[model samples]
Target: MTQTTPTTPVPPGALDGTGESSKGEATDNRARSRAAGPGRLLAIVLTGQLMAVLDVFIVNVAAPTLRADLHASGSGLQLVVAGYTISYAVLLITGARLGALIGHRQAFLAGLTVFTAASLACGLAPGTGALIAFRFIQGAGAAVMLPQVLSLIQRTFTGASRAQALGAYSAVLASGAAAGQVLGGVLVQADLFGTGWRPVFLVNVPIGLVLLILGPRWLGGAEERPESRAGGGAAGRSGALDLAGLLLLAAAVLLFTVPMVLGQEWGWPLWGWVMLGLSAVLAAVFAVYEARLAGRGGAPLISPRVAGAPGMPLAIARIVLAMAANAGFLFVMTLHVQGALGYGALRAGWTFAPTAVAFGLVGLNWRRIPARWQPVTVPSGFLLAAVSFAGVGLALRDGSDGGPWLFAALVGVGTGLSFAYSPVLTRTLATIRPQDAADASGVLVTSAQLGMLTGVAVFGAIFLGHGPGVDASADALWATCLALAGAALCGAIVGLVIRVGHLR
Candidate 1:
């Protein structure tokens, strides 16, 4: 919550440190002046932020519809939904580095342009394969644009203004997520001029275009690259890209993700198991290589300092698990309500609104609690999530709606997850020094994306792996919910360890 102070105000021409510095600085200052107020800057940042976050969940509501229209296989439908996350998670660190290298404002706008174009492509896709490809591109755009948001806030605002801006960031996250569900449903049900599921994606086009126009007008260039001023290590290799690290990380995720996603449709083939096993080995290799890179004074893809900060890994793990379980629960419920129960898309979408609202409420207000009690909330939240997940499974087991109990369980799960995630993330970032903010942000964001990706792939597999039949699907969901509950318990255990170490 403390303001990052490394962003000393740049006198005109200081940012470029070049022969034509005056022109660049004048241009930068003029842009900054136009969007001078924190309100204007945050408006631009949060709108892009909302669009990026909303895309992740919006597809969930449209999944069943996509399947019907595209004639997508079960795995294909999952691909349509998850392919964006795959590329997004894998490329996020690279995207952060890219933003740092080529000016944050430019990166954001370029990325937004790519995202908008890809959304249009997704809307117009002729087949499932094409749609899946476009989704990956869309995710890439998000990865590029999103990391700059916090950087911009850190640069443009100070003190109380910065804190409020950060609050707005959090609010947008909650609003975007909840709004995505309801909006996706409404758009689908209305069929938007009979466009069917396409509108869920097409909706981004106009908004993206508006942001694209406003982005250049509103956003100012600061020390978008924290390394330039904060620390010496990152400065040493300002232009370096970690090719080896990118390869290893991508391979590891792909090995694990591809198998988990396709194994169900592929009948749990031997190759899938082999790939899954290999992923662990690659992950270990990635870790070792990154430590060596950082130790050699190179800019590693992920900073070990940020990741290995006191009590940081444990705190981050709790969030990663919490995210996985949270995403998994949403995916499974969508499957149940839309696929098995035959609920309309709008009705099914409404079912998730309570969870999103509850999560937003808890996340936004947890700070009001006494500081002393905050540590326990992490573990306690996970424990609550476990119970809520169990209740949801029990409620959903019979084909009929679990009625009020279902909604209540959803609300409880949302609250539990908000407590588990939001506080831990704030504390986790607090562990990093200002110079390392971008890397720290990259580590946390990449991990969160990875968690969501894992949840969708693994939980989707667990739910759909069972042979066909409503009874079979329902039984699979119960088992998946139990599995998710176990994951939350693990998160709780991790949180307790963090507390025992006095790492709050």
Candidate 2:
């Protein structure tokens, strides 16, 4: 009998001279690829986030130039700013759903692309109407992009990694806002590309281009679900797109915001009142529709359950009120310095730099504050902000020259304290389900935007109605600051309630 040696078949690329080396090299490549993947995605997403946040403030310094160039009136100027914010707020929920349905990465890229194009259109806008319309579209795009950032970070990372990523995200958000103001000032001052105020919008083009190009490669596709992988459920979740709900919400916001913004300018016209009535009706209808959907187990545009959560609505209300006060303070300060005090735009922009610097410094050490101290810090910060506002009021009353510096420093300190707990709020909300997180964030942003719009309108109305004389302006500003202080007092009360209720 022949001795038969059984030859075992080696696996593909197993141990042939270079085969093991090749396998090891392949493994190394994959490990490196995976390791680099999330970081790359984060960078791209943060860039997009930065762009979105930047747009919010980038136009502030350029507002005067834009107004002059486009022949826009005060109302038109408000539209230019408020139109974007209003549209952005209305579309946020829809955008989030769209991202979930179509795909986050695809949606993010598409939104970025649209936003970039709209930025160009805004730069080239031939008239005020064109600029306003384009800004609305740009805002729509931003609405789509911003939510996915949170979604992406949440879905991608987990555990401590997720916390760290979120912290970074929050920091980027603050930095982007601060940078927008500074960069807008610089660009307007420098007259880069000779585009004048247009460069503020145009600058987004290159940054956006970089994001669009790199995004797909870095962001990967949406996470594959277990059910999706098993092919046993809908590929993406199944729920109607809620177009009716969306339209109603849009109508409601427009009816409410348009009238609020234009009412004072148009002398509280019949049309404004009509729109206000219509807005109320639309809001009621929206509520009914949402309730119906909820009862049917269909996903409502917003989750009523989350919205109705204990303390959440109150928390949001306080946030809105506080933001409204902040907006009024900013508006009055801007007008006082540039319009009344005859300071140049550059000088005015520089005036706020101290506040920004202080905010950044405090924000850097935010983590050092104990968790238990967050409740105290938030209210204390508000109190400080109120005091700062009062200081400005006093400075105005005293007719002190170069007084904005002291007030600005106080503002910086107050802002730093005010934001100290934002991270804590974010983490607390994150513990909720993903959809809840989305709903909560949407609600918070909406409240903040509305507060800002309302603040400007209310404060501006008071100022203009009384006339913009030095004394009148000063009085209006002081009253506005006092109102904000009242709001901070309210927030403090709420904080106490939260602490007490939690104890109970």
Name the candidate that leads on lDDT: 1
Top-scoring candidate (TM-score): 1
TM-score each candidate.
0.85, 0.82
Question: All candidates: CA RMSD in angstroms?
Answer: 6.7, 12.6
Q: Cα lDDT of all candidates, in order? A: 0.73, 0.66
**Model 1 segments more than 4 A misplaced:** 1-35, 73-76, 156-179, 222-226, 232-237, 465-474, 498-504
TM-score of 1: 0.85
Clashing pairs in 2: none
lDDT of 2 by residue, 1-504 (tens): 111111323233221112221232334334433754877888888888888877877788789999988889998897897777777767776776666556567778888999999999988889999999999999999988887787666545544445556666655555455466677778888887677898899988998988888877788754433212222112232434567777898799788888776677678899988998999999999999989977886666776645664446555655666666655666667777677677666766666666555555554455566755544555666666666666667667644444655656456534643463344344344433343444555566666667767777787676666566677666776676666666656654565565455668
Q: Which 10 consecutive positions of candidate 1 have the poorest summed lDDT?
A: 1-10
Tens-digit lDDT string for candidate 1 (1-504): 111111223333221121221232334434454555557778987888888888988987887778999899988897887788767776777776666666566777888899899999999999999999999999999989887776565445543344445545655664466668878998899998878999999999999999888777677544454456444224325556677887898788778777655666568799988998999999999999988877887778766666656556675687579778877778788878888888898998888888888887786777677856765777788889999999988887876688899889989898898877776665444434444555666677777766866776778788887876677777888899899999998887864454455533
Q: For candidate 1, what is the lDDT?
A: 0.73
Clashing pairs in 1: none
